[model samples]
Target: MNDVIIRTEGLQKHYVLGAETVRAVRGVDLTIHSGEFVAIMGPSGSGKSTFMNMIGCLDTPTAGKYWLDGQLVSTLSEDELARVRNQAIGFVFQTFNLLPRATALHNVELPLIYAGVGGKERRERATEKLRLVGLADRMDHKPPEMSGGQRQRVAVARALVNEPALLLADEPTGNLDSTTSEEIMVQLRALNEAGQTIVIVTHERDIAEVARRQVHLRDGLIERDFLNSTVETTV
Candidate 1:
């Protein structure tokens, strides 16, 4: 079996604004292996977000190919893409996207519910994931009852309930303080160490340093992709 969880060749995305065409991603190529932790960093309008969307199956490219776990998803229909997304990807965004009225367990159970899992099994799975994120004691707590970090942990737990093949985090630390950001990063780092393949998009250099590899983009194209020998071991 192939270990390459993500591979893209000559990937391109363009947008037309009136008569002018904006080239968002210009023939970019990338590959990420299983269990690898990678960070994509770039300034505003650098196409980092666009690239993330493409790889996450949230958007399609105008040109080029995207092979996710050896499956060509760039050409999949909307319904097919949604199916692939639910089965293969977990997303953690800056906003912690939790239901205000739901308990952490219920929030985590949402994904499994969408996937047609039974009530008993969904509860078991959600509970296990919350435990993995160090929130076993907070299963019954609602979003309003938790701190920002705790809410983000709930979001992380929710993301993992479906056992996705890839975890895509977009500016996960953007809404947290420095200390809380590190706290979240610690949990994410632990998850990666336990064999979760993660691709995080961040513009903060410190946040990006936690990953083993970094890919930088500029003007809609890759500027550099290199191993980070000095990746921080601590959150």
Candidate 2:
């Protein structure tokens, strides 16, 4: 009743890999409230990635229930899930995931294009988002023309273009250096301070510390859930 943005009850996912049934997620029960910044931390093969895929609506749960923004996501069909993903969530990947040939502005506009937004509106909104991420001057540059941090900033801008209820970042700083990672964290902290609900997945404790709460996953089950002590001081 506390304005939950995401809720999952007994969520589960299983994968068959080479005659072995891998239980990626086993009964994950979670509640993420609006405007909360949460991090998911786990070792490799601990099922955090699978959990993120389920939360982002990129993959279906093998069983159990998931609700996003008061709607039953686990009950939705593939097409319906796609619609929900476009409307309710934004994704930031470990890699920048920008097209090499596309300009930064065009890369940021990709989501708008899929959503069928008008070209003029897309350009205006993309520009505003890029400016917000401190990439206004590099709108015309391609991925190869930008540094790793700059490319990631473009990806962040793209994610924000939809203004979705949830921002999902999966190892967003994995590809960056330590300095750049801190810079990206600074930006994310600022966004969270501005009331963006964020769910970040990372293996690094330093990175996970940026969030207000942390959920630890092990062997496809939640091992720990606690409030993070390192709150943003400057943001």
Cand. 1 Cα-lDDT: 0.93
Instruction: Compose the digit string of candidate 1's lDDT tens values, residues 1-235.
Output: 2399999999999999999999999989999999999999999999999999999999999999999988999999999999888889999999998999989999999988878999999999999999988999999999999999999999999888888989999999999999999999999999998999999999999899999999999998999999898867775
Give, for candidate 2, the lowest lDDT window spanning 10 residues.
Answer: 226-235
Q: lDDT for each of the candidates?
A: 0.93, 0.93
* Model 2 regions more than 4 Å off: 232-235
Give candidate 1's error at residue 200 in angstroms: 0.3
Tens-digit lDDT track for model 2 on 27-73?
A: 99999999899999999999999999999999999999999989989
Task: State the displacement of the C-alpha of residue 1, model 2, in Å, after optimal TM-score superposition.
Answer: 8.7
The alpha-carbon lDDT assigned to residue 7 of candidate 1 equals: 94
